[model samples]
Target: MADGLNDQRTVRVADLLSDFRTLQYYIAAAPTEPSHSDDYYCEGWAALRQCSIDGQHILNCAAETRVPRVRGGPDEQAKTELQQVMLDSFSRRHEAQKIYLRQAAAQRWVEWRDSILCGGRPHSGNASQLASCDAQLRIDLAAITDDSIYSDMRSSDYQMGRWTLEDPRLRDVQRWVRARQ
Candidate 1:
């Protein structure tokens, strides 16, 4: 146990490097734009969010290592280099976090869209059921329309597909319901 402190620093530095690389991979793999599929977007976002946590942990580890407990330790120079590398990686990781937030906003949009669109396939296909679905959907939409996130989403860099951005929202589902009636 004489080398325990050195061993702990070694382990922490190794963990920091591993997490740094994982953060880079997540940033590289991140979608250029949000996907239409909720599952796809959610899965990707979850991975990125986890990486964000890892990145933060890396930063914390780097800070701890930089505390200069023993200035002339054998690995001091190596630790200094690692700290610089970690700092550089952190900037890229911050950009990844922005992407993560935009994706979360995009996912919210998808959920709202799905809530309205899923109303079309009731088992009964009866007018009463269709009307009930529409009523609930309208209420749901109304409840969320005033949320400022949608406005931020409008200004965000990602593109919503043509089908989603069309005028008179819920057009497709409304048409289907009218046809059924």
Candidate 2:
């Protein structure tokens, strides 16, 4: 999706950086309300996933040796620019990944809420079937929180440290899920 930033023309680092910043702002401002459409969660999650991919690509580009004659060669200035761009992309990606996790939790909370409202069981109601569904959702959540994204502190390129800060909305959702369980 972001290939255009690198492929459509000369790698315009400024344009790429602008795109990253815009996405970061969009993700940060995304609605966390339950009343918001599923589209918001879907779009945000997709965007974050794409950001992770693009961030990794940028990191890889930064790590590669620059040949002297091809693609304008590598210079000290170019290296520094790449470093800054990669850092910015990764730093934003890390935060966006956490937001995606919160969205997943919120979506699950909504599912649980619906199930409860339907008299402690979903329409499918088969224990084995529900177990399978739960497993799938858990797997999906795990993917978003995977080591490549947010779960591993080592993967955090920016010194954000461990994800220790609490998201109050997430906490409330967790509490509700536990109380119902």
Candidate 3:
């Protein structure tokens, strides 16, 4: 009974370490959204901090070790670069939305007049209303697309075939399987 209990504890510890490692990897790889700088990073950091607190031993080792400046080998650099590009593109789109919203707000009267003259129906009562509506629309659309893309990227069956260790429990299982094999 004591042996079984010890084995269970060891397994739990290993799982915690694996989870810690996966969270660290995510912090290093996930991109920021331009709509709110540091939002995603803050969330990721908080998660990592929690993992560190829970997995003290693994966290200590990670803190002492220096992660390489580059992730993956040269062979995978292209894929990494591509992912970065996609992230940048999304960030730019979010920025563009903000700029457009601001401009639309500032020129609400002109926009309304132009749209009305161009045979489009007016959506709001005043400049502020129009701006708020526009901003909401942009935010909603961006969020939908962003969520879809992020979901696809995080999917277990994503086609790009990059190594993602998002789930700590899975990492533990993988390590144990490899060790046993």
> Pick by TM-score: which candidate is best?
2
**Over 4 Å off in model 2, which ranges?**
1-31, 34-74, 119-181
Q: Provide the global lDDT of candidate 3 against the true structure.
A: 0.36
lDDT of 1 at 26: 54
lDDT by residue for model 2 (1-181), tens: 1222222122433433554465555544543443434434443334444445543443333322342332433444454445444444444344445554545554564565446445443355455555554565556656664344443533342244322222123333333323332
Candidate 3 to native Cα RMSD, angstroms: 17.5
Alpha carbon lDDT of each predicted model: 0.41, 0.43, 0.36
Error of 1 at 54 (Å): 18
Could you tell me which residue pairs clash in candidate 3?
none
Error of 2 at 121 (Å): 14
Tens-place lDDT per residue, model 3, 10-77, is 34334434533554454333322323333233332233333334333322322212223455555345
The TM-score that candidate 1 achieves is 0.32
Model 3 lDDT at residue 119: 45
Residue-wise C-alpha lDDT for candidate 1, range 1-181, written one tens digit per residue: 1332444344444543554466556545544433443444333345345545644453443232233444656576555544433333333333334434444443454455345447443244454644554454444334433223334333341343211121112333233223332
Sort order, TM-score high to low: 2, 1, 3
**Off by more than 4 A, model 1:** 1-74, 119-181
Per-residue error for 100 in candidate 3, Å, reads: 0.7
10 residues in a row with least lDDT, candidate 3: 58-67
